[model samples]
Target: MSKVEIYDTTLRDGTQAENFNLQLEDKLKIAQKLDEIGVDYIEGGWPGSNPKDIHFFSRIKNYHFKKAQIVAFGSTHHPQKIPQTDPNLKTLIEAKTEVVTIFGKSWDLHVKDALRISLERNLEIISDSLAYLRSHVKKLFYDAEHFFDGFKDNPEYALATIKKAIEAGADCIIFCDTNGGTLPFELETIISQVKSKFPNISWGIHAHNDAGTAVANSLMAVHLGATQVQGTINGVGERCGNADLCSIIPALKLKMGIDCVTDEQLAKLTSVSRYITELLNIAHPPYLPYVGRSAFAHKGGVHVSAVKRNPQTYEHIPPQKVGNIRRILISELSGKSTILSKAKEWGIDLESEDPEVQKILQELKDLENQGFQFDVAEESFKLRIYKARGELKKHYFRLLTYRVHDYNTLDGRPIAEAEVWVEVKGRERHAISLGMGPVNALDRALRNALEEFYPRLKEMSLIDYRVRVLPETSGTEAKVRVLIESRDKECVWRTVGVSHDILEASLQALLDSIVYKLFLDERREKC
Candidate 1:
């Protein structure tokens, strides 16, 4: 098998995505993870772009990397300026990295329209940029921006642009599908042409996902002789996204029998994907290939049964190969077989014929009928089962009652005050609090009353609250379902509640959230 160099541009290109910005500390943390996962090159942001990027480059120099070379990214010299005098090129040298990657205009249209430079000047810019950086850095990679589009428009000029980089000592000439509109067949044909033209030149592919063929195009280029592949983690980038290294790396190794990351490093794919998503606070796509939560999840009764017997029956590859696991989701659509499968995974001693299993299944179905979705609220489902089987401990605090009052203040702003009465460990406690809304007031009052008894409750807080109406037919009177995501230092959990009134629905979810946190603590103590 041939080796493909993995160049990660998550910190550079990934930040261009909407709502995907990372702080300086976050970028440093990600760079460490990338190096630990054995990426060949980690492209930190351009040092000349902002003070943060400059600081990142300065700080990154202090750390020792294990396997990856930190590469600084920037554009080629300005059309009117010489290489030594170009600010962008000067910052590239000042970043003090062993490798530098710079992009140049490949499309003649971009030269004339975007840069407003003659075709001859663009070639000189590309050559001078690489030649200058070639002396300062151990290795240089030239990115031919929009190479695919350029080749389609003027193949002669595009080839000439890359030849100039090759002559100027670029270790790798990376042909980029900047617009990401090139089809796989077109990419394959173009890559084949380039390989034939320069048999001895080191080649790479940098693709985006606008056409949804970034992975296919990248692999096709490798098949045609590209030795390096550049992408962002989980495909985060401008527009559609860059090729997802999470999906592409595994495919290159397991599917195509090409080696990019080692077997040991490949095992960290799922964790790396999740770590990045978690840091960004983004909802990971459940259906994302390989590393998604639902990638190896079995939902259908027949599929679950077959998967239980042999995972290879329904799965293309073992979930563990990518550090992911098979999941058996329980829902109203599930059957007894699925329940038994999930129970077995949770270490519960149960069978399909158990009366307890039947009881739990019926309760789940009824709850689903009442607009409670267990698929997204598995923590609530587990708590329900534990309560039904008498394995759950008694409540730490029993709610006697709660009252909320809404009134206008002197300034005419609506204020909500809540009074909560709860019995904790045989004694009753009363607390009152005010909030901007009824839900917030109730949450504050409840926490105020309970915090004294269970001081650990101070650590638990609601991170997100979501509500959805059951049906549009009832309009404002429709039953609403509320899901609350709560997190403590150790873990995060989701709980659900439903009611006709919005406040009541939120209360139910809020109560469940607090109860689940205590329940988790109790289980930990028993263990």
Candidate 2:
């Protein structure tokens, strides 16, 4: 098989995604991770558009990479001027990277309407940009923006655009599905035609995911002889997203037997995918292919049984190949076999015939029937397992009573105060605190009461709180389920609680959060 280059544009195109902004340090960190995973090209960002990217290119020069080439991305020169005179081109040159990628208009409609220039002028822009960068950079890739749409609209003009870039010394002519409307079959046909026309030229593909076929289109193009594939780590980009390299890389290397990153580097794919999402502060798409949390999670009884006997029965590839583990989800739908499998995974030596397994299974059913979703609350599920096995320690602190008061202050702003009484290590402690809301006040007061006994609680804090109404059959008095995410220096864990009153539900979850933290502290000490 041909060697396919993995060009990652997470820093550039990915930041365009909503709520996916990253700091300069974050960009550097992601770049390092991508390099470690053996990405061939890392497109830092568009250099001239913003100060952040300009600073990134300047600072990144100090760091040396092992395998990946750091590529500066930018658009072709303005239609009104030569490449050298274009400010964007000048910024690309100033970036001083060995590899530079410049995208130019291929669609006649964009050239005629968006650029408001003739198709002839657009051709000049493409050639001039590639020729200018070719001398300044060791590798110059020309992105034929909207090449598929342009080819379908006017094949002659679209082919002319890439032909000019190749003739003018573009290292690789990358066909782009800028609008992401092209299907896989359409991309295959168009890519094959382009490959035939320029049989000797190196080709690449950059696909977007508007129609949800970016990954398919990209792989089809590669099968049709394109050598380079450009995408983001988790397919994060403007609109839907670019093709997900997390899926594409493994598909290429493991499934197709194509050489991109080495086996050692490929194993880091899941870690890289997760690390990028953490930096973006975005939740990982749990259902995403290959590396997603649910990708290898078996929930059904038959599926879990088959997976336990032979993972290949339900899984396409071994999860550990990409640093992900096979997961057997225990739920109301799970059987004793599933519980046994999950127990083995958790290092709990529970036999299939163990009465405790049946007990926990019944408890899981009853809790889930009450709106407790174990899938989202894994920490709570683990705690239940420990409790069922009679291995759970007693709570570090027990709440005696708590009072929350809410009233308008002199400034007419509502103020909430909480008085918490708790028994810690057989000693009663009392504390009062103020907060923006009743829940916050309760949390503060409870922490204050327990801090004397468990000083380590100072490092833990509630990072996220969510409440979901159960059934809501009773309009005003519906039971609410609260989920609280707590994080310390060590790790993040979520705990859940349910009650008719929202405040009470939140307090239950908050208490569980503190208890879990204390448990971890005790566990570490025991170890």
Taken over the whole model, the C-alpha lDDT of each candidate is 0.89, 0.88
Error of 2 at 446 (Å): 1.6
Model 2 lDDT tens row, 117-220: 88898888887778788889999998889999999999999989888988899988899999999999888788778877888999889999999999998888
Best by TM-score: 2
Specify the poorest-scoring 10-residue window by lDDT in model 1: 518-527
- TM-score of model 2 (CA atoms): 0.94
lDDT of 1 by residue, 1-527 (tens): 46789999999999999999899999999999998677999999999889999999999999899889999999998888898899999998999999999999999999999999899989999998898888899999999999999999999999999999999999999999999999999998888788788989988999999999998888888888789999999999999999989888888889998777788888898898999989989888888899999999888888888888888999998888888988888788878888787777766778667899889989989998989887777788878878877887677888899899999999999999999999999999999999988988999999999998888899987888899989844988799999988899888888889999888889988988888888878777321
Clashes of each: 0, 0
Looking at candidate 2, the ten consecutive residues that score lowest on lDDT are 518-527
In candidate 2, position 389 carries an lDDT of 85
Write down the lDDT that model 1 would get. 0.89
Rate residue 259 of model 1 by lDDT.
72
